[model samples]
Each structure stands twice: as structure tokens, then as C-alpha cells.
Target: MSRRSRPVVSNRVRRFFASFIFDKPAAAPASVIARHRLLNAGAYDEGSGTINGVMLIAVAAILISAVALGGNFLVCVSDARSAADQAAIAGAESARDGDFDPCIKSRLATTLNKAALVICKVDEEDVTVKVAVKTAVPFAPLVSRMARAGPVECS
Candidate 1:
């Protein structure tokens, strides 16, 4: 073949193995080197695509779990608020009716709701209640709700 038609090799291998002095084999033609590089690039792209797919699935799963947890927490909050309101109203009505233990009436009102009363305050016909319920979440420290009720004394 004519010298002009022979493939030329650039300084690629020389840059990567600068310290090695062993007699290297004959350099491959430029076309062969380019083909090898393209094959490696395709393999790299395939591996990258697979990794990205797995990561996307994992992230989507985590996001779905978070949304479900938020919904459960909202239910807990709603139940807690209901318990507080009913307890406060019961306490106020008991006080108005001259019950011996108005706080006992408030406690009885929350019996079926599975809520624990943190505190109950009575001042004349007004009553306030603070309640809490256990949550099915991890690392939850404090979640409570408060409510107040009273009969308007027009005197």
C-alpha cells in the first residue's frame, strides 16, 4: 500500500503509559482503535442507563411512601381534634348540670375514641381539654390537640 494511504496513529497510548518502557507490540491501525473506543463507549452508555433506571424506581418508591405516611398522619390529627372537642363539650355540659366530677364526664366522653387527655380546666361553665393519641410513625415526639367549650352566661 502507498505510504499516504496507511492509517496514522496519534500520541494516545504514549500519554496514558508514559512511565512504561517495555517494547510495545505493533500499533493498531487508526480505524481499529476508533472502533474499539466506540464499542467501549456503547457499553458505558448501557451501564449508565441501567443505573439511572434503578435509581428512578427507588426514588419513586420513597416518594409514594412519604405521601402515604402524610395521609396517615392527617388521620391521626383529625382523630385527636375530634377527641379534644368532644371532651371539652362534655366537660362544659357536666359543669352546667352540676355533676359531681365534671372531669370524669370528659374522660368518659373520650372512652371510645382512644385518646388520652393531657389536661382539663374548668372555670364556671367553661371547660378546656387537651388530648393526644398514639401515632404509627417513627420518631414522633409530641402530637396533641386542644379544644374549649362554654355556655354564654348573659348575666
Candidate 2:
């Protein structure tokens, strides 16, 4: 006897045919449904969502405030550094130009930049200066910076 060949079928096609022939589960009794409802009544309560949202908003606001304060402190520090450098350069230039007192000009420069001259030292044509800028933040110390400027000697 000659064997007849069968056509190949994909698993997807088999599953598609099988879906229409599955056994259905029996319906639950009314007592079981009531018990399930009673057991899960308090598991999904819904009053804390508002509280959680308010707490998240408060936390985000606090983070934004902290970042703003940190950025302001950084700007104050940069301003202090610039004031010191300008004062040092002024002192050095006065010394090179044969002025009477280089420190006086340095002090005036720092004051005009909203900073106080902390220290001034001149060694020949080189000038070193330290300046301080007061911060608006309560309980924060003054920002201080130091700088030196002089004419570079050619080799």
C-alpha cells in the first residue's frame, strides 16, 4: 500500500482552531462571591491619594528652594573672586606707575565692587590682595577671595 502525505500546519493555525473548543469553568456560588467581596473591601481603600500628592508637591518645592539658594551662593563666590582680582590688578598698576600708595587704590577698587579689602601686600611691582563680600543669606559667613597681579618679567 502506498502512504499518502499529510499537509504541514503551523502551531498558530492549530491554536486558532483550538480557541473555539475550550471547556468553560463552572459559575461560582453566591456565598463565595459575597465572601470574596467582604475580604477585599478594605484592601483597596481610596483616601490617601490626596495626601500622597500633597506630600510630593511639598518635597519638590523644598528641592527647588535648595537649588536656588545653592546657585545664589555660587554667584556670590564668583563675584568675590572677581573683586579680589580687580583690586590686585589696580594695586599692581599703581605700583608700576609710581603712585604714592598702591594699597589705597586697591582698597578703593574693592569698595567700588561691593567688597571689603581684607589685606593688601605689595612687593616691588607685584601686588597681592584679599577681599571679602558679605552674603545676604542669614547665618552665612562672608565670601573671601585672594589674588595677585604683577608685570611678567621677560626672559
Candidate 3:
């Protein structure tokens, strides 16, 4: 073939291969490419603003739950202590009357409003009393199934 024709044929073959083998491989959809680039660049970091926000929210939730639990515990403890005091007083009174059952029953009845169980025991010179109180809090049906504060003594 003449030199000029040779150049023409070579150019034609090159163009054919370019079209078939290397034409811009379909540009990945823009969104797909963007996601890949973001991942490759490590755009998400543990110390980033989004992570900090999430940590703050978790801490706040934990603190609120703790406060609620503490409040319920305090209520139960206070009620139990009050019942114990009342029981001791009634037991002492009953000892004077030489009757134990009636005094214990009366004390328990008085503390019903506070949702507590009261027990009284008389021992010669000292009256011993025990109280178990139950309190209801959100989510928890009953806090401290039985909260025992002390055996208040009365002489």
C-alpha cells in the first residue's frame, strides 16, 4: 500500500479499537460515585460533630434515669422509717395495756396510706418495731420489693 494509505488504515483501526475497548466506561451514576468518594476519603469520624451529639444524648438519658431511680428509693426509705417510728410508739402503748396484737394491728392500719407493712414486738423494757414499705415508680412496678429501714426502739 502507498505510504499515505498506510497512515489512513492505521488511524481507522485505532479509532475502531478506541470505540470498542476504551470509550469512557459509563460514568458511575453521580450518587454512587459520590458515596464511594466519601467512603474513600474517610468523611465519617468518631470525633465528628454527629458522634459528639449522639454521645451527649446518651449521657443525658442515663442521668435522667438515675435521678428517677434515686427519687423512688428515697420515697420508699422515708415511708419505711415513718412506719417503724409509729409501730414503736404503738407497741410501747400496748405494753402498758398488757396487749400486743391490738397495738400491732392498729399501727399497721394507720400506715396503710403509706403502703407499708408494720410489725411490733415488746421485750420487757423495750419495744422493737419493723417496717417494710413498697413504692411504685415509672416502668418499675415496685421499687425495693421490701425496704427495711430499722427496728425503732421505744422504752
Candidate 4:
């Protein structure tokens, strides 16, 4: 068999290849890397970063919508509770004044407070009323509140 001679790699090429492949891990001169984020940048589409940003925006929008809906629901609950308390107070006053039906006045009070009086009951100079308030939310959910007021009892 005839012996063949192998081509020798120059020191410069060896260093360049080493730096390209091994990241020049041995404190290589940054210049040989050639251009800061210029060429290798094209190797990747960077679309993943764009997708991540879009996903973040969508998540933020959903969170904001939830917060708004929750806030509206809380307001509706408070309004309903207030309306029920006011209606019960009005009914209690009517009972003290010897009204045959305090529910009629309670209905008027609930209406003035932007709520619908669902039920009213009177027993032993005590008045109890249930009221429902509707919110302007997407499905217009109603918040219901019940309150009772009676003459003060002292021992």
C-alpha cells in the first residue's frame, strides 16, 4: 500500500473553528466572533419571542376583564344590601304607624333605591324584606339581599 500525506490545518483556522464551535470558551478575542448579533441572528426566526409577547397581552386582557366583572358584581351586592335595609326600615316605621300592609310602602322604598322588592313579611311589629338589584353587567345578574327590622326590646 502507498502512504498518503495529510493536509495540515493552520493555527488561525484552528482557532476560528474552535471559537465558532466551542464558543471560544478559552477567553477568545471577541473580534474573531465577528459582528455583534449580526449574522447568527438570521439563523433564528425570533418568532417565538413575538408569540410570547402576544400570549402575555392576551393573558393581561383576560385578567383585566375579570377584575372589571368582579368589581361590578361587588357593587351590585352592596346596592342590594343597602336597598333591603332601607326597605325594612320603611316597613318598620309603617308598622309602628298602624299600617294594614307595610309591604306596599316597602315596595315603594325599594323602587326608589333602584331595586325590586321580591318579598315582604310582617310579624309581631317586625318587618322583613327581600330585595334584588340588577347590574348592567354582561348577563345582568341580580344580587339579592334580605333584611329584618323590629321594635327595640328592653329588659
Clashes of each: 0, 0, 0, 0
Instruction: Give residue 128's error in model 1 in angstroms.
Output: 1.1
TM-score of each: 0.69, 0.66, 0.49, 0.68
Q: Which stretches of candidate 3 lie over 4 Å from their true place?
A: 1-48, 98-103, 106-110, 136-155
The model with the greater TM-score, 2 or 3, is 2
Please give, for residues 1-155, the per-residue lDDT of candidate 4 as tens digits: 33456677888778767887976556545764654454576735657889999999999999999889989999999999999999999999999999989998999999999899999999967999999998767776788999999799899
Report clash pairs, candidate 3: none
Model 1 lDDT tens row, 1-155: 99999887658756435435655555666876898998987854667887999999999999998888777788989999999999999999999999877889888877768888889989888999999887766756346999999998688
lDDT for model 1 comes to 0.84
Which residue runs of candidate 4 sit more than 4 Å off their true CA positions?
1-39, 136-140
Ten residues in sequence with the least summed lDDT for candidate 3: 142-151
Segments in model 1 whose C-alpha atoms lie over 4 Å from true places: 1-41
What are the lDDT scores of the predictions, listed in order? 0.84, 0.88, 0.60, 0.88
Q: Which ranking of candidates, highest lDDT first?
A: 4, 2, 1, 3
Candidate 4: Cα lDDT at 76: 94
Against the correct fold, how does model 2 do in TM-score? 0.66
